[model samples]
Target chain A: MKHFVDTLHISGIREFSEMYINKEDCIFLTIGEPDFNTPTEIKDALKLALDENHTHYPPICGNHELRQRIAKLESMSFFESYTENNVIITNGATEALILAMGVLLGHGDNVMIPTPCFPLYQTQALLTGAEVSNYDTSTHGFQLRYHEFSKHIKENTKVIVLASPNNPTGIVYDEESMITLHRLMEEHPDLYVIIDEVYRSMIYEGEYPSIRDYESTIDRVILVQSFSKTFAMTGWRVGYAVAQESLIKQMNAFHQNLVTGVATFIQEAAITALDVDTQFMLDEYDHRRKYLLKRLALMDVDYIRPEGAFYIFIDIRKYGMDSYTFCKQLADELGVVIIPGIFFGTEGFARISYGANMDSLENGLDRLDQFIREFCL
Target chain B: MKHFVDTLHISGIREFSEMYINKEDCIFLTIGEPDFNTPTEIKDALKLALDENHTHYPPICGNHELRQRIAKLESMSFFESYTENNVIITNGATEALILAMGVLLGHGDNVMIPTPCFPLYQTQALLTGAEVSNYDTSTHGFQLRYHEFSKHIKENTKVIVLASPNNPTGIVYDEESMITLHRLMEEHPDLYVIIDEVYRSMIYEGEYPSIRDYESTIDRVILVQSFSKTFAMTGWRVGYAVAQESLIKQMNAFHQNLVTGVATFIQEAAITALDVDTQFMLDEYDHRRKYLLKRLALMDVDYIRPEGAFYIFIDIRKYGMDSYTFCKQLADELGVVIIPGIFFGTEGFARISYGANMDSLENGLDRLDQFIREFCL
Candidate 1:
């Protein structure tokens, strides 16, 4: 008689955005998917792998060369203490996150997640029967303040889920904030931290900071990242987790029962992805990021400048409308698609992704500006 | 501090089988990996798909055409109640199995698993904190008897996990047994039945019996299958689950959080998989199956004749060794590898796979004969 599904409600992002897929004239800014084509080099490597019959199951952990490639990348990006044992390829960062949940949280355990984070964190925790401890970061520009952890760390809290550059708000944690959080976690050695950095490659300003930079050991930090955002390989669903070897080994156990590993040629393609030039996509995102920032500045609304990722989180509180209603009216009337911030667990704001061409962004933003001109008055 | 990893022990299929990957003289009948080259058509289709850049994140359920193809296959093979809504593509039958567990079993709930069987079923159940009620089918010639279910059913028994053309034992369920199991389920409407049919395509004799033959509705039957064993596409990690619309929807929720569905171009390739001529591989497996059966007939060992899958579960009890010890000693002394039946939860029998070519099978069987002559004496 006990069912977990009733505790879960699918987020509003898809419910509202799916209606616009067939509207050719609609300037959509809804989902986080990028518009860049997968790199020619990566695709070429995949084609070669297909021709060479690399379509067999790689080891459940991953193809050795791919894991090795990820290890080398992790060494430069994360910790030197890590090796191949510390990395395991997953379906994507999505599976990577699920594995983290599997290893860290148990029934009736607590998982602390910042509000307006990816909905999946809460979904997975609930699926595993873990209670989600959501801390609203709306007041702090969506960055976790040290007090946020202090106020919410319960005796049952097992893991802290952090995303940076954060979804919706695109606020990357500063070095000071990262160090302070580490200090708090160091005091509670029992707590685990998983930082999702899918948007690390899309940073428009400053070096992407990682918890690995402040922690002396790889013991507590579990870094989940993907080739989707960086390599325009979202559909490929190739991602990984870098943690202490034991934690990774445990995650691989769950992953082994789940997908075994990502597809063989897909991992092979991802190996070649390491060498592909990602500057074109990053440069384009930067161009669009700046344009959207200027649009935000001129709109006379409260909005945080996106430090990284493609989304701009803007407050719609002045309109006195719920986030879903605001987004619904915006899409239906103005022919623009944007995600309700309530979908990410906050209201009175919505996230607009600028991961599209300049023409669409201009069109969508102009529509937004017109809507604001009429509605704000 | 709490971990599910402790409940999961890696299966010996890998630990012993891996020792031979670099040994040229080694005759391995270990893992169920097929030795046949992947059919050219699936690879060709995949190649074309990659060139066209079919790589993108598929829907959480799957691509429309891929689901349609699977639904069409199910319509003829399963109930007419099946449509795209009844089918959900997974990472493989492995992920499909895991998703079934996620949607069906909750913590402290009971799941019935027949042994010797694939170890992943027990692994996934425990990962979700579900208690596994394993029923040893070794006494029944590795077939699930009506008594097996009657004995194992408990107050919390929520699911009965079945595999047709059983792994390790290779005994397909006869129609009468399938109907009997269905009748038992009909008695307990709350009990779910999941039959893994990954090896359905590899049967050497008799029509593969499905629950669909007796049941007009798909409500209680969840069919998990993969393209790996059948199409010689083990490495692609593509598979599907067919159930009623509601169960598929719940499974899709987990599938969405797990890997967001299989790869895009991979699913596109799968759309072509339905049309790939499968008779070639079927004839090859039949040829190999007859050869192994003949060899088993000449041997002085007790073995269950495999009806479908690539394995022959031979009794090694005469050697007076536990399954793991028997396998280890065989690999060390005879230069052969056979999976320890204990890995599948039954002792005194070892599973030898004929999924390889004629040469490897002959060599491995000869080594086994030599080992038996020396040890059985």
Candidate 2:
């Protein structure tokens, strides 16, 4: 086995999910996927594609129509220069991040990612033979600060990864942070940023504060988007990345050999997904988010108010237990599963997902409250 | 950019296909996909899965039921010890190959492939920073000879990649060759073999002589299979790899972070695909293959009889032009597209795919004949 493969282990999030997936009556607040099913229109489109015999191999990048649709949708919020040529549909945002990392990072290069980030980013960076430099974000309420961001940069730093409506924190990067990141990129002309916006559509507040707002830094940003969250299509494994033509071309070369693009019929369906109304799912998640926030507050737990995505990272340091041990005991004793913050490169905290059903969330919170009282009080 | 990404290019086969894709009245024999639509049963299963709302994240390795079905199906032919733990559902055989390569190979290691071979193998090996060692098999009828294979083995050669009913040549390895390979493996205890059997089900002749027949060597053999060629599910992007439990665990770690897994509903549909009868499509391909062989014989072109896959590699050396020039001129002047042999790491040859309809095949052969008479004579 290669040294990297030897060092690589299954994601701790997956490890915990698998551990309790089959436990009777367990309420899973550990999932990162939306509980809702995919919309009917998208499913119908896939069936229609099947009826049309769209079963042959698609273009290496993706179907031209799907790329065009994606480009049009993204252009409205980001760079107007976006075109079909600037996009490559991937297996998922997972593959998109790996493709971007593979194209940009090599041996002796450094990829800086915020601490308490999506775990896959670290693993994907390591697979490319690049060193990972974690920019700890817990200090700034999990937001990017200009001075703190600059402190993590090294001469070998090639790429920086950020997630809007981040995985564990659920704190959307404010416009000020985006501007701060732009400043950092300007200082390091060679730096590229991979902005994972998989949770972009689920934001409950104002418009998504996109980094592409800075025209000068637009070319340096690779936007990773997915239909999984908003459309409840996680199993569909369809996502895309938008970048400059030259960079897109390089990523496409790796994408072609890696998975030969996403499923063709799925791409046709994704075009339909771009037009479907996702506000209903977002509304339901916001309802759950508010309820969960009320419950957590009554328990006197310390947590950042989640503005987007479906997670709330709550500090568990007061309980005097590590995140994994605390979550394990909760699942074992209370039948409520929450993800350990260590899975996202931070300890002494745990992430609770509001993507589950209201009943499950209610039951899970009650159990979590009881456990916290027993452990903390 | 990474040096390897800079070095990689879009496949030559895709380049020619794209060049002629929009050309009116062009007959394409450049595709490696089956012309048949995916079996109806599989498509219907996918539709049913959609109706059932099976659209959430599947297990990182794959859905448990699909893995069990695959293990059950593969065990009857390969190793009876095969279990669900030994299998990983991938995006396709393409991802399977890259995953196997990624897990087992690293910088300074060597990967040996027989040529003329699939071009992606070379690129994927290079992506892992491993040096690719091509053991040119064109000198030996594209079959493995014990002494010839041994000559290419280096001290650091960690993997040997082989294809049965191979992409360009359509030649299946015989039992004698498998025995010779098994003998070589006995001498090199650290060596691993990745046998790509994507076209395994399409063999028109006798049973496929798999390398896994040797129980001792089976542990080191990673078998890659696909539904694309067999059930005509190319656009579906589903395939699998089977290895010993330990190796499968390592590859699954990569698979989890790489693409998560194949689409969830697609895996459900793949279960229905396993029971699909594909003899009708195989019969059609064989009929076209026989017709193509007769046409080539009448044209007095040197070629090998394809035993399994739907391609016939014809020698174009007599035309006094390189493979690319000959193929380019054929498509431009005669509106017939055949893949240049150089795409598969050989020159002075061109590959004609019989995967197209008989009408296209007849017309393509006619155009090829005209080009030969005008240029070769």
Candidate 3:
């Protein structure tokens, strides 16, 4: 095995889950997938693609039809000048991040990301022999403080990764925060910023902000979007990268050697999914978010109100145990699953996802509250 | 962009094809996709998965039903001890190769491969910072002469890539040859061998030789198989890697950060594709191979007769031009397309795929003969 590969470890989520997955009957609050079924129109489109024999190698970037749709889609959001060439369909945002980093960062190069962000950014950057400079944002309630750039930014930092409606924390960056972030990126003209908006369509409290809205930062940012959260197509393996043509072309070149492209039928379905509204899920998730928040306000738990996505990150610092030990014991003693926030690089917290059904969330949170009472007291 | 990405060049094959793909009335002998559509049963299975709402994230390795089927499928060929745990379903054979190389190799490690092989291997190895040692096999009619392994074997050579029914050359390794190859591998227990059998099911001659046929070398080999070439599922994004449990676990961990897994509907379809009999395409390909051989015999051309797959690699050296010039001129003047051998690491030969319809192959080869008569003379 290569020395570098030995250094690459599985994410903390996988490590803890594997230890207890087969021991069923536990209410898993660690769910990242949505509980909704795929929309019928999308499935119909997939059937249509298969019937049409769309089963050969896709264009190295993606099918131009899908690309055109994605370009149109992005133009409505943050990119007015985006075109078919700007988007490269990927297996998912994960592959997009891998290709973007693989093409942009190398040895001696570095990426600056907020702590408690997705571990994928760190892992892929490491795989490319790049270093990571993580800004511990836990002190700021998991929101970006661009003024702190001088604290973590290094001379070799080549990319900045910002995830809005972030995993675990559900921190959605609005236009004001994004403008400051964009200004920070403009100051570092040599650096590229990656904006992960996989949960963009699901934002409940505020509008999703894209760096592309700022012309100065648009060329320097690579926007990644996913159909998994919005369309409930996690297993369909469809997502795309939206960026300037020159950057996308380079990323596409690297991507061609990694994957042929996403499956054609899946892409067709995703294209159809573009027309389907996501308001239903947003409303459902908002309900769940409110439900969880109401209960937390009544309890002794310390938590920041989740603004978007499906997670509520709660600090367990008052309890003597670390988040990992607390979550592990909670699951072992009770029948609920929550991820330790230490997994995301902040030690005194844990994340519980409300992406499950109301019943499971209710049952899981009840068990969690009881465990907190017993363990903390 | 990273300096390495800028250093990577577009392939010669693309350079030539792009110059002629738009010119009308062209006969394309450069097709690599099968003429047959995906089997109806496979399509039906994909539809079933979609209807069943198999749209959640799959296990990092794969869905157990598909992996179990793959294990059973592989055991019939190269590995008897293979299990569901040993198989990691990938986006395609491209990703399988990437994960295999990334997990098993690193800087200072070397991979030895024969010349005139797939450029993907070299491109990916370079991306991973591994050195490539190319052994020229054009002198030996493109067959592996096992006795010569000692000359290229180095203390740092960690991987040997062997492709049977290979791309461009179409040479299948028979059982006797594989046994000797196995014996050679047994001597170097430290080296990992990657056997790309994407075209294994398209064999026309005798049985395909696998290192797994002999148990001693089985543990050290990573077998890569694809549904694209055999089942015409290229656009479906389905393939898999079979190796030891520990290695597969590592690969799957890496895969988690690259792709979640193949789409669930695609995996379900692939499971049905397992029962699909590919005798018809094999028969058609054999007929085309025979047709190509018969025409080459009468033409004033030098060539190696292909034993399997859908290509005929003909020596264009006698035409008094490098392959790029010959192929480019042929496409421009004769209105026919073929890939230049320079793209495959050999300079004097060109590859013509017979995977097109009979009419196109017939028309293209006739024009090729006329080009030889006019240009060679």
* TM-score list, all predictions: 0.96, 0.98, 0.96
Quote model 2's TM-score for chain B. 0.98
Clashes of 3: 0
Residue B198 displacement (Å), model 1: 0.5
All candidates' chain B TM-scores are: 0.95, 0.98, 0.95
Quote fnat for model 2: 0.83
Q: For model 3, what TM-score does chain A reach? A: 0.96
lDDT of each: 0.82, 0.89, 0.82
Clashing pairs in 1: A56-B235, A57-B235, A235-B56, A235-B57
Q: Which ten residues in a row have the lowest lDDT in candidate 3 chain B?
A: B1-10
TM-score comparison, 2 vs 3, better candidate: 2
Top candidate when judged by lDDT against the true structure: 2
How does residue B287 of candidate 2 score in lDDT?
90
Worst 10 residues of 3 chain A by lDDT: A1-10
Which parts of model 3 have CA positions greater than 4 angstroms off? A174-176, B1-3, B146-149, B174-180
Q: What is the per-residue lDDT of model 2 for residues A31-149, given as tens digits with 9 covering 90 to 100? A: 78998999999999999999999988888899999998888888986546689999999988999998899888988999999988999999889878889999778888888888778
lDDT of 3 by residue, B220-278 (tens): 89989899989988887789999999999889878887886788778878888989898
lDDT string, candidate 1, B64-146, tens digits: 98898888888885447567998999888998898887778776799888888888888787766678888888787666678
Number of colliding residue pairs in each model: 4, 0, 0
Model 1 DockQ (Cα-based): 0.58
Interface C-alpha RMSD per candidate, 1 decimal: 2.5, 1.5, 1.9
